[model samples]
Target: MSDLGNTFMRRFVQFINTADEKLGEELIAPNAEFYVPFQSEPLVGPRGWLKAVEVMRGGFPDVQWTLEELVVEGEKIAARYTMRGTHEGTFFGVPATGKKIAIQTMNFYAMANGKIVGERGQPDLLGLMQQIGAVPAPS
Candidate 1:
């Protein structure tokens, strides 16, 4: 059942890194729901998913995604991934820091019909800001 979730993640990685919207279409359902903190809108389709990733990559041109752990059960999958990138373009009003940053992220994905049905994106925002020198570390 959830084996589809694992397959989806594999295809997602290739789609995101390559900016291949066509392949992305095959990885997400027509009405997939995506929840991300960075964006106010819940992405609704593959086109939206592709656009969102493009914006993220534009902000962090050297972004790299590293999957550290993965778990699957029935129709759900949980993945922990590390992201490393340089701030090369403006992001949500923050001027480019030109600093390399790493953020630890976890995602829960639900799959149906070999495509993602639901996606929840979570990341360590505080750690990322601190690593990028955007904020001071806790004393």
Candidate 2:
């Protein structure tokens, strides 16, 4: 199961880096749920996951996530990543600053039958905003 989880996560990273819908569909279950920050409703399925990726790409077209660490237990996996990109476009209503950003993110995934069925993610959004000059940094 650990090996399967690792392989699944590797493919997931590839899907996110490329934003390939077909690969996403193959990796994620049809009824998968993703709970994201600041959103009341959970995003569902591959399309929903891709929409989130699109939102990130809207700000950082070259954004990429690197899996730094992974831990698997039963049907669940916890992953830590370093997300890097340039602020080349609008993001969350904030204008582009042409700055580069590298932030950490932690995500947990639940898988069943070799497909991801659920995910809960925590990203360093405040750090990203600060790096992009959208928010003030602490003294």
Top model number, TM-score? 2
Report the C-alpha displacement of residue 23, candidate 1, in angstroms. Answer: 1.1
User: Which portions of model 1 show Cα errors greater than 4 Å?
Assistant: 1-7
Summed backbone clashes in each candidate are 1, 0
| Candidate 2 ranges with C-alpha deviation above 4 Å | none
- So what's the TM-score on candidate 1? 0.89
lDDT of 2 by residue, 52-131 (tens): 89999999999999999999999899999999999999998989889999999999999898889999999999999899
Supply the global lDDT for candidate 1.
Answer: 0.80
Q: CA shift at 134, candidate 2, in angstroms?
A: 1.4
Highest-lDDT candidate: 2
Estimated TM-score for each candidate: 0.89, 0.97
